[model samples]
Target: MANDAIPVRTERAMMRREDNPFTFLQQEIDRLFDGFGRSFPAFAPPQAMMPRMDVSETDKTIEISAELPGLETKDVQLSLADNTLTIRGEKKSEREEQDKDYHLIERSFGAFSRSVALPEGVKAEDVSAEIAKGVLKVTVKKPAPKQSRQIDIKTAA
Candidate 1:
């Protein structure tokens, strides 16, 4: 029985130190968004799922991608206005079975909407969206950089 006992290592494990400011800011932002949906309790859905999305940008274009599993292009609607891009969709599922002793029925429905604020000069015509294999990808062609000019400062008399 003594031979079967395992050895105990007592050395303290190294703890990873993360950048706290960024982490705290991220946590605060997440809390804000989490509360946003529930703020209007009367209109909140019983079941709502927010899709995970990623946004990236380069010199020429801005790209956005969202993971929307079990959803198709027809089920989603995209609109751009006032430099804001919005994605809205509804998911519905129903199952029914009836035979001899019992009848079982299940139903689920949910709607979700998310919007992203684009930078200035992003035109609606320059944006394109496509969904493939449960992933929605949107690309916005960035407009040419405008030349900056200095304005003379005037002092009030």
Candidate 2:
């Protein structure tokens, strides 16, 4: 009898057309609130979306830095309220010459606001902010905790 080898084949996985949960949820919510604009058209105003931020913290202080290129110090606003720090700003572009036509305007403009929660020990009063070279830097000092004294217990005879 002649020996014969059997061939084995591997199957490839089929690509699935699954909808992302976040996108689907957003679409559904938009559909549900489609008539909201019609009911309160006057309440709606054209507003730009908030920019993303990067926050960092240390034992002594918290540091918040945001990218705000082409924005001057006068254009940015920094405030702290109820343990929340907010940074708001607007980017404006003006044509230097009226005769010059802009071929492309890809740069983003308009108002942007971002807020971050201050840590438990942060001192709001001691917070400091500065804008240098188009970057906004905010430093908040951490409050020192009160030291607790050790209590020794004595046994009664």
Candidate 3:
């Protein structure tokens, strides 16, 4: 049997889609910020050190997942108010060795905060948070869906 296979074209590293002006502008802006971060690490915003988060919504609940590395539950704090969930935590460095030669200190040890807007129906009082491994999960209960009703029309007599 003869082998017959067609070659599939794949995107190259240099072939980026920058036709949209906004996309180009966004890329340029991101590059500018990257330069700033590399140049002035200490001047970076506290929120930049905050862990990244993802939010998802369902019919009756809102769930949020955050990547919080090297943090115990005691080191983290959370609060919710006015339909906004605020996450606060500090990454502390424990250097117990006094005579050990230090070569590099790249770990970040500072307080960081992040706030997330809750959906319309979320109940602030009915919220729960859990920390497992290096991830933090938050769940907020939303109001129940309204029941539909029908009304009969009456003729004027």
Candidate 4:
């Protein structure tokens, strides 16, 4: 009985690593999307997904600038964590028109989020954000570099 079980165990151990359950599922999903896109090209997105951003750093501060067109100061929010910064915005727009011959109305809204990883020296508490002309700028002061101290230990005489 033991000799018969050994061959089955060996065959099971010979399974390929790429045959992992999650990886197999991902490959199947990718294949489905490939075929679906060939059948219907309109399902593709019309525009880019997220807003464009620029990140720069100076001697004492780091700056992040994002281009958010048609957004006001109150439409965006910022948050910071350990070496990570997050920006979220809600774009709510509305329009109305009336005339003797015709009338029309339009409204649209969406929410977007972007997260960035900052350098090691940034200070979250000193971060600040400002919006001007549809551009959002965030500044974070760089903390002073940490110094290492050596401790001395004495043995009993």
Question: What's the ranking of the predictions by lDDT, best on top?
Answer: 3, 1, 4, 2
Q: Between candidates 1 and 2, which one is better according to lDDT?
A: 1
lDDT of 3 by residue, 26-87 (tens): 99999999777556656666656879999998887888999998988998998988878899
What is the clash tally of candidate 4? 0
List the pairs of residues colliding in candidate 2: none
Clashing pairs in 4: none
Q: Put down candidate 4 lDDT per residue, 75-153, tens digits, no spaces.
A: 8988888788999888765555656686432222467789998878676678998899989999989888899999999
TM-score of 1: 0.58
Please, what are the lDDT tens digits per residue for candidate 2 over residues 36-58?
54445333334433555678888
Better of 3 and 4 by lDDT: 3
Each candidate structure's count of clashing pairs: 0, 0, 0, 0
- Assess candidate 3 and give its lDDT: 0.81
Question: Considering lDDT, which of the candidate structures 1 and 3 is the better prediction for this target?
Answer: 3
Candidate 2 regions with alpha-carbon error over 4 angstroms? 1-49, 96-103, 146-157
Q: Which lDDT tens digits does candidate 1 get at residues 4-41?
A: 57865444333233545676788889998888657654
Query: In candidate 1, which residue pairs get closer than 3 Å at backbone N, Cα or C atoms, i.e. clash?
Result: none
Per-candidate TM equals 0.58, 0.57, 0.61, 0.58
Question: Which residue runs of candidate 1 sit more than 4 Å off their true CA positions?
Answer: 1-48, 99-109, 149-157
